[model samples]
Target: MAAAARLFRDAADPDSVKMADIAQAAGAGKGTVFRHFSDRTGLLKALVVEETRQLREQVLHGPPPLGPGAPAEERLPALLSALLDLKLNQRALMLALERAGAGSPYLNPTYDLWHSEVAGMLSGVHGDAAADYLAHALLAAVRGDLVEHLTGQGADPDELHEGLRRLCGSVLAHRADGTV
Candidate 1:
C-alpha cells in the first residue's frame, strides 16, 4: 500500500498521471492498484491532501527561519525559499494535483485559522492590514510562475532573501509605535 501510494505520487506531473503508469511504477498489477485506490481520482485526492498538510505543517511549525516566530523579513524569505524548493522537488506532484481541479488544501483547513495565525504574526511586524496584505502577497508570489522564474534562473537563496527584505522594508519599515 505504501509502495502504491508513493508510486501514485511520483507518477503525477504537470500534465497527468495515468493509472497504468502508477501501477507500473508501484510494481503492482492494475487490479491491485484499483483495489487500493478505487480510481485515479481517489489516489490523486489522497496524495494532494496529504502533501498539502505536510507543507502547511512545515510552514507553520517546522523550524526557526522557516516557521513562525522569525521576524517578518526573515520569515518572508524563508517562506519563499522553502516554497521554491517544494516546487522544484515536488514539481510533478504539485502540478498534477493543481490540474485536478481542487481548491488549495491550505485554504480548506479553515481560512480563519490560517488568516488569524498569519495575520497575527504580521500584526506583530506591521499593523493588521499590512500584515494581511503582506501575507496575501507572499502567497501570491510563491505560485507557479514566480517559483519557476526564480528557481529556473538558479538565483541564490540569500540574494532572494535580501531582495525581499529590501522590498518589504520599503513598504513596511515602521516607527516604534508600529504604524506604517
Candidate 2:
C-alpha cells in the first residue's frame, strides 16, 4: 500500500499507473498483488480507506468540534473543513479513486457515511426536512473533481478552506435567521 501510495502521489495520471508497476514497486509478484487487492479499483479504495482511518476515528470518538459532543453548528464546519483538507492533501489518490470505475460517488459507502453525518448535524440547525438535501449540496461543494479542477486552475488551498468556511457559516446563519 505504501508503494502504491508513493506511485500514485508521483503519478501525473494515477490511472496510468498499472498494477504491474505497483507489484514491482512493492517487491511482490503481480499474482500476489492481485490476490491481495482483487483489482486496481480495490487497491485505490484500500489506500483511501487507510489514509482516512484516522479522521474516521476522530469523528467517531474524539473531542468536541469534530466528534459527537459538539453542537451542530460547530461540528458541521469542523467536519467539512476536515474533509476539504483531506481532499486537498490527497488530491491525486482521491482523483484516482473517484475515476476508478467505482460508480457515482453518491452511491459510495463513504459518501453515505459522510452524508449521514452531515445530515444529522444539519438537522439540528435546519430541521430534518432540509437536512438530507442540504447535506448533499454541501458535500457536492467538496467533490474530488471540483477540487481538482479548482486547484489545477491555481486556486490556493487557503482560499478553498476559507470559501468552505463561509459556505458553512452562511448555511448555519440562514437557520438562525429562520430562512430554512
Candidate 3:
C-alpha cells in the first residue's frame, strides 16, 4: 500500500498512474494487485481512506507539540503546519484524488473526525463557541485556498504558523462589539 501510495505521489502526470505501474512499484503481480485492490479506483479509495485515517491519528493521538493534549491556541497552529506540510509533500496524490473524484466527499466522515478533534481542542480553552469558531477557522485554513495563497506568496511553514497564530488570537480575544 505504501509503495502504491509512493507511486501515486511520484507520478509526474496525474492521469498516467496505471495499475501495472502500481504493481511494479508494490513488487507484486498484476493478479496480486487485483486480489488486493480490485482496480485503480479501488486502490485510490484505499489510499485516501488510509491517509485520512493516518492524519486523524496524528492529529488526535500522535506526538505532541501537535496532538490533543496541547492547548488549543498552540495546537491550532501545529495542526495548520502539519496540514501545510501534507499539502506540500503530497501535492500530486491530492491532485489525483481531486481529479478522480473517487474518495470520500469533503464533508464526509474524514471531515467530521477533523471537526470533532479541532473543536474539542478549542473547547478546552475557549469554551464551546470559541472552539466552534476555531474549528471552522482551522478548516478554512486547511482547505486549499488559504494554503495555495500562502504558497503562491512563497510563505514558508513558519510564516504560516505565525500568521495563523495571530489570526486565531485576534478572533479569540475579541467580542462581536469590536471591543477587546
Candidate 4:
C-alpha cells in the first residue's frame, strides 16, 4: 500500500499508474498485486482507505474539535477543514479514485460514515429536519473534483479553507437563529 501510494503521489496522472507499475515498484509479482486488489478500482479504493486511516482514527478517537467532545460548532468546521485539506493534499489519488469507475462515492461505506458524523453534529444545531440534507450539501462543497477544479483554476488553498470555515459558521449561526 505504501508503494502504491508513493506511485500515485508521484505520477502526473494517477490513472496512468498501472498495477504492473505498482507491483514493479513494490518488488512483488503482478499476479500477487492483482490477486490482492482484484483490479485498478479495487486497488485505488484500498489506497484511499489506507491514506485516510489516520484521519479516521483521529476523528473517532482523538481530542476535541475533531473527535467526540467538542461542541458541534467547533467540530463541524474542524471536520470540514480536515476534509478539505485531505482533498487538497491527496488531489491526485482522489481524482484517480473518482475516475476509477468504482461507482458512486455515495455508495461507499466511508462516505456514509462521514455523512453520518456530519449529520449527527448538524442535528445538534438544527434538529433532524435539515441535518441530513445539510450534511450532504456541506460535504459536496469539499468534493474532490470541485477541489481539483478550483485548484486547477489557481484558487488559493488559504481562501478555500477560509471559505469552508465561513460556510460552516454560516450554517451553524443561521440554524441557531432559526433562519436556516
What's each prediction's TM-score? Answer: 0.62, 0.90, 0.69, 0.92
lDDT of 3 by residue, 101-149 (tens): 5453353565577678778766645678877766877677766445655
Residue runs of model 1 more than 4 Å from their true location after superposition: 1-13, 29-42, 48-58, 103-117, 125-130, 149-171, 174-180
| lDDT score of residue 117 within candidate 3 | 76
Clash counts for all predictions: 0, 0, 0, 0
- Candidate 4, residue 101: how far the Cα is off, in Å: 2.4
Candidate maximizing TM-score? 4
Give residue 27's error in model 4 in angstroms: 1.5
Which pairs clash (backbone N, Cα, C closer than 3 Å) in model 2? none
* Cα lDDT computed for each candidate against the true fold: 0.60, 0.86, 0.69, 0.86
Q: Is candidate 1 or candidate 3 better by lDDT?
A: 3
- Is candidate 1 or 4 superior in TM-score? 4
Instruction: Please say which candidate is ahead in lDDT: 1 or 4.
Output: 4
Model 2 Cα shift for residue 60 (angstroms): 0.7
**Candidate 1's residue-wise lDDT over 44-88, tens digit each?**
556655655665786678776757777765665565566656655
Q: In model 3, how large is the Cα lDDT of residue 156?
A: 85
Q: Output the better candidate (2/4) by TM-score.
A: 4
Give one digit per residue, the lDDT tens place, for model 2 in 1-180: 999989988887767789999999999999999999998888887888788888888998999899998987789889999999888878788888888775456766677888999999888777887999999999988888899899999999889889988898888778834775
In the range 1-180, model 4's lDDT, one tens digit per residue, is: 888999888877766788898999999999999999888878888887888888888889999989999998899899999999998888888778777664556766677878999999988778887899999999999988999889889999999999999999888888745776
**Cα deviation of 91, candidate 2, in Å:** 1.0
Cα error of candidate 2 at position 84, Å: 1.2
